[model samples]
Target: MSSSLLPFILFALVASISPGPTNLLILAHGAHNGLRASLAPIFAACAAAAAIVWVVGLGLGEVLLRHPLAQQVMSWVGVLWLSRLAWQLFRAAGEPLHATARQRFGVGSAASLQLVNPKVWLMAVAVIGVFATPGLPVWHLALVFLIIALPCMGAWALLGIGSARWLRSPRHLQRFNQLLALLLLVSAWSALLA
Candidate 1:
């Protein structure tokens, strides 16, 4: 591996693996639905990250970020959408376990979420700015991002899967779900005001 690529790979790993809405969602889903059912959202997030990196490498992300109005609009949209998801999570504790499969965060929604996910945009734009020199192809950089990102995201969900067993009882599961919901809300708020 080229030394030039190491820093970027490390950056991608840390940024993607660190706690974020996507990871939180993955963990939550894994806890509720187990590994098999949690894969969709993980893949969705990976696809979304790839797409975001590609678009940003094309320079569209920088253009969007340069405009304050656009940034504000994106932030608001993300905040509103996240708030809604948080509410749903808060209420999820009341639903039956059998409904988990049907209620899981699917590919479409997870992919769509990237549009409003500031961390994704930031990661893409930062990667493009830092690593997308003339010698490197943007697509390859995107692939690297995906290569590193998918596993990191999956790890979090898998951890949640491990936690699933601990939360088997209805009362325990409900409390776990409610706690995740509260964390989701806090995450949304941090995204908005922080």
Candidate 2:
């Protein structure tokens, strides 16, 4: 409840809500499936991200960041994963919601991917290194993460659900899927360049 914690919580919320690979994927899932289906991945992602934040907060992230090769490897992995996702999205045009939901990555798999996802890693590092106070209790940090990340991510998922309403026809859905795929590809490229 300290004033110092507020900034960190807000920062975490902002970062979580911002468009990124994870959010994009969740949005795609929600649009294709439903808001309920999106929840699994969102929870998984948040849990995974929280674990990374906790580890990094304990000082492991700094060590990982120091290795240039590691960062490059992560970048490449992220690009590959996202590219694959993009391909799937492109192919999902005109597909049934059930098929799309089945094809969507599982929560655990998506969560595990965060380890190699540059955006998630960067967010984890920032949250742990910048927002979290060194002397503060661990529970406080956990609370901050839960308070901020859950709702932010949930909102993104909800957006996808809302978008689904607009896509009534197969052609419209196809175009929407293609656009998302393109966006995912661009995001992957951006991550690689970063």
Candidate 3:
């Protein structure tokens, strides 16, 4: 890769691996359900983010980037959605695990939710639009994103799985959930400032 490409790769990796709504939600899913259950959402999110990046890198994302109002709208929507998620986490802090089949993660709503997910949008705009050179062949950009996103999301899922061991206790799980929720809420608030 050329020297210019190196920065793009690093930016993609950092954006993809950093803590965000998708990561937190996946972690929660892994903890609440299991690693297997978390796979669906993780893969779905990865695919969705990749698709968005591809679209953005192709120039569609430019429209969004140029429109400040649209960006603000997205930011607010993300903040609201994350706030709602945080509330749910706060509420679930005291709940008991029923261990139902439906609780397991799957390629369902979670995957589709990436459409409205703010973190994914931010990533598409910041990394794909800003870092990825528009002149590059689309396939090359796609390949780079695929290589970077897959393992990064998997690492998050694995972290969640690892944390599950310590969250076995209902009380401990509850506290963890609450703390995670608080963090999410803080993230949402921070988004408003950004």
Candidate 4:
């Protein structure tokens, strides 16, 4: 493998594995829904993130750089959406895990979250700027990111699935949900504050 690819792979792994809003949501979802059900959202999020890298490499990064207001707008909208999700998750903490089917965080929502997430965009831009060399095309970076992200995000889901064992009781599940919700809220808002 090329030396450049190693660094990019490492970068992708760190970015995807890090505890961000998406990873946290996946973890919470997996804990609530199980790995079988959480697979769709996990794939959706990885694909969406890859698509962002591809688009940014295709010049969306330049457009975003030229228009700071657009980033601000997206940041506000994303934060609001995340806040809403967090609120819903918190409110549903008292409900049984099976009762959370109504609050499903599905493929579309996962993809949409990536679209609005400033952190995702920023990461895409960074990947393109730092990794997209003359020999390493944008598509290559995106494809690599997609490949790396899947398992990284899946790891979060697996954690959730594993935690499901301990969350058998309603009270334990409630606390878990509330904690995840709080973390999600903080993760979303911290981007703007940063």
Candidate 5:
């Protein structure tokens, strides 16, 4: 790889793997639902992310960026939507987990979030703005992002699935859920600000 491209590779990896709301949701879901059940949301998030990269790389993001009113409206909606999800997760944390998993966040629900998630919007815009070149085919750049990002996102789910064996106690599990809830709440606020 060219040294010039190293930063983009590192940025994509770190950004995807970082504990944002999406990854946190994956972790929470995977921990409770097991790997098999968690597949829907994990793939949903990946699909949404890749879609973002594609749209932004194709320069459609400029249309949104040009319309500040549209951007602000989406940001507020994102805040409200995320706050609602965080509230539900927070309340769920109080309840003890059962052997049968509650499959709440499915493919449609998770994929729709990309529309309102400011972090996703920002990441997509930033990646294209910084790394995409005029000469390169936009889809190729988008594919690079997809290739690097999807697997990194999957790792968060893996961590959660792996932890299922370790956090066997009810109390430990409750605490973990509560903490994830708090983090998700914080992420929602941060997304609003971003």
Candidate 6:
């Protein structure tokens, strides 16, 4: 391992492991579904985030920086979308657990969430600005992020799996869902409010 790569690796680990909207949603999904079901979303999310890093490094970050209005619009849209998800999670708290996997959070939704995920874009910008050496390819950083993110996000899924055991009862599950919803609501709104 080159010494130059260590800091970037640390940054990627922290960014991926931290509880953002995506991580929260993944944890919730894993709890609702299982590890097997969580795998697709995990891969999708990691890939999407890596893609964002690559694109942002390539020039999207410059475009976004030049347009404050665009950034504002994106932020508002992302917050609104997150708020909607939070509401849905809150509503699910009251509903009885149906055996049908009708409303499961899948790969497509996970990837789409990355498009609107402010955290992802911000992290991409930071990664480019700070870690992207002049000689290093953007794809190198993207690949590094993807590699570091997998197990970090997977840890969240494992936590969800463990929590699933504790959340067996309806009352417990309801409380857990409600708590996650509240957290998601706060997280979604805090960036704009700050």
RMSD of each: 1.8, 2.0, 2.3, 1.1, 1.9, 1.5
Residue-level lDDT of model 1, residues 67-105, one tens digit each, is 968877887888788778877877878665667757878
lDDT per residue as tens, model 3, 1-194 = 55557777787798779887777777777777777777768778777777877787777777886887987787787688778878977887876544422555456656655666676777676766455554655556666776787789888878877887788788988898898899888766765675
Q: lDDT tens string, model 5, 1-194?
A: 54436787788888888888888888877777777777777778777887888887776789878898888898889878888888777666645455426655688887888778888888888888878775544676667777886788678878988888766777778788778878987887887785
Predicted structure 6, TM vs. truth:
0.95
Which pairs clash inside model 4? none
Worst 10 residues of 6 by lDDT: 94-103
Model 1: worst 10 consecutive residues (lDDT sum): 92-101
TM-score for each candidate, following the candidate numbering = 0.91, 0.89, 0.86, 0.96, 0.90, 0.95
Using TM-score as the measure, which candidate wins?
4
Runs off by more than 4 Å, candidate 1: none
**Tens-digit per-residue lDDT, 1-194, candidate 2:** 66668787777777788777887888887777787777788888887877777787777777877886887887788889888878877887788565666777678776877876778777777776666665665556766686678778888778888888688777888888898889888876876786
- lDDT value, residue 19 of candidate 1: 76
Q: What is the lDDT of residue 189 in candidate 6?
A: 82
Q: How many residue pairs clash in each candidate?
A: 0, 0, 0, 0, 0, 0
- Which regions in candidate 3 have their CA more than 4 angstroms from the true location? 99-101, 104-106
Better of 3 and 4 by lDDT: 4
Angstrom error of the Cα, residue 160, model 6: value is 0.7
Instruction: Please give the lDDT score at residue 47 for candidate 1.
Output: 82
Task: Give stretches of model 4 more than 4 Å off.
Answer: none
Local accuracy of candidate 6 as per-residue lDDT tens digits, 1-194: 55558899989999999888889998988887888999999999999999999999999999999998998899889999999999989888855445414678899999999988888888998999988886667899999999999999999988988898888788988998899899888877875665
- Residue pairs with colliding backbones in model 3 are none
Find the candidate with the highest lDDT and give its number: 4
Off by over 4 Å in 2: 137-139
